[model samples]
Target chain A: MSSPARRGRPGYDQDAVLQIAVEAFNLHGYEATSMGLLAEKLGVSKSAIYHHVASKEALLELALEQALGGLEALLTEPAALEGPADSRLEHVLRGTIGVLVDKLPYVTLLLRLRGNTEMEREALRRRRDFDREVSSLVEAAQSAGSLRSDVDARIAERLLFGTINSIVEWYRPEGPLSAEELADQVIAMVFNGLHAQS
Target chain B: MSSPARRGRPGYDQDAVLQIAVEAFNLHGYEATSMGLLAEKLGVSKSAIYHHVASKEALLELALEQALGGLEALLTEPAALEGPADSRLEHVLRGTIGVLVDKLPYVTLLLRLRGNTEMEREALRRRRDFDREVSSLVEAAQSAGSLRSDVDARIAERLLFGTINSIVEWYRPEGPLSAEELADQVIAMVFNGLHAQS
Candidate 1:
């Protein structure tokens, strides 16, 4: 709507439109936001905006898919996929943390989606699949008597994954530590005790 | 908004109204949903809606207040607040997990807020306070020589809270494990090794 005041750029550019959409969704939330608001923010006509992305839901899907893809790649890395159980688990955990940090905004939005729409539900499904794979590693480690058996594999899986997923809450790359350093710190804390093991 | 339509007693009661609002907020998001939709779904006038709560923000505040109060209560419980350091730490962890299970919906929403609004920022501050208390417990446990010292207290604190906060992602109470049982399992997995302790 505010595009009326603009003089020259009459068309929507896909990448620029997506950047605006990401900010809008991040600031106001996907469901609360409107197409008119998005168009105004991007300084483009509604139809011009539509020309780049079919619908708002499509934009959500695009962002979510990329975030999930980063996660999936980390899970499937040869190091994460195959190694001595401890080594493999560490790789996966560190890689996952790295993904969350690098793709903070996108992953933050993805994590916030609670399956309200078809796209969100699908995102949830893919996420579960990824979790399922990670749980198998937890189980394998448990069966090997490497992990403590007192906790069930499922609960361990949830706690470990939960901790990794929480990074998006405060992890800002520009703030202090690099994503790599943060990942290393996370692995050390989760694997080693706060007090030096005597 | 729709209260006049249901002037008859076929109208919803207070619990019904709260549930409808929760569902709408959960689906469309808290910020996007309006009292008008809530009234429409309840088949009541906005005046009838006012009979229950002052405004949409009030409903949100009420919901979050209950969830955060549960957490604060857990921290103050004699078991969680006292005893040898490790025992107290364990008590807080188990109690917080139980609280999360009991108030899953509200806590989940609270965890996802990004502080865009004054209410959200206050909620976040309350959350940090909880984290600070938990971190103190971890520090005490380390000082008491119960926890290992290989990791820094701050990093350990993040992992501890992150693990607990992650619970909302997949902890379905309807699933096989009861909340207490899940807590037990979490403690074991976190404290024990995936590998046989060397």
Candidate 2:
């Protein structure tokens, strides 16, 4: 349903509205960010904002999907699926860093969700599922004798992704480190460690 | 100045109040948790809260100090300061995990701070300074040839601590994993990595 008012703003589509709404949600807690505040941030009337999304929760769902989708897709990728368990784990790890760098704000919002709402709870559930998938992958690597078996696979998965997820706390695209370099360092540190190999 | 009402509440001392307040801030967020809500949560009058601390920001400073103080202490510990650079780094990393586990709620509040207030900014400044100190340790280890020189020291520090800081997300003191075990796994992963050593 195209309206003259909607057409007047050429760039402010559902995507733009979602982006700004996500930024506001990330800045202010999702519960605290009202649609009125989002509309104010988007420089649009409340009704105009509604024309794009059904509600603020809808915007959150869309934003979370942008992040979760990337991660879920990584699990299904040929690189993630085809290789030896350890190398496949590496592919997923690198891919996760790419998703985080590419869709930083969305992933930040996803990570920060406290499951206050059902939508948030569902997003968190999906996140947990993703974690289980990675954990299983780690287990496979351990079984294959590529990953060290002494440490619990679940703990190893948590630490590996913990370091990756923390990138959202500080990584900036315009900053000195590229996403590729970041992935390289993470892979190196988690696989080979900081200790010099003799 | 203890009033009859204050004397009536024997258990609600300043430390107790600060602990609950930190939990509230971590749950509801610092900006959103007003004195009224905190008072309601504490089952005390607003004035009772004031008797413990002058203002909300004062409570925040106390909570942040609880977290930052622990981390800052690690930098100066005899083990942290007196050992081989890499061993010292290991000591600090293990000690940081100890602090995070011991002060989980306070550290969660500290890590979640967005610097909306001057006190938060000050905390962030202190956090950055702590990061710098650790980064310098990483550099020292690299220089000593104990740690790999390939990754930048600053990046190494962030990943090391990032993995450490992430413990607050899933770690429960009541969980099966003891703090010592968590620290051991972290040390093993960061220093020796997850790959099977030949």
Task: TM-score each candidate.
Answer: 0.78, 0.91
Proportion of native contacts present in model 2:
0.72
Best model per TM-score: 2
Worst 10 residues of 1 chain B by lDDT: B188-197
Q: Give residue B122's error in model 1 in angstroms.
A: 3.7
Candidate 1 segments whose C-alpha is farther than 4 A from its true place: A1-17, A31-61, A116-120, A192-196, B1-28, B31-58, B113-121, B193-195
Give the Å shift of residue A128 in candidate 2. Answer: 1.0
TM-score of model 1 (CA atoms): 0.78
lDDT of 1 by residue, A25-127 (tens): 9888797788888877877668888889999998888888778999898876799867777678778888788878877888888877778777689899998
Candidate 2, residues A62-102, lDDT tens digits: the string is 99999999999999999889979999999999999999999
Q: How do the residues B117-191 of candidate 1 rate in per-residue lDDT, one tens digit apiece? A: 898799889988988888888888878888765556676778777887787877888998899888776665455
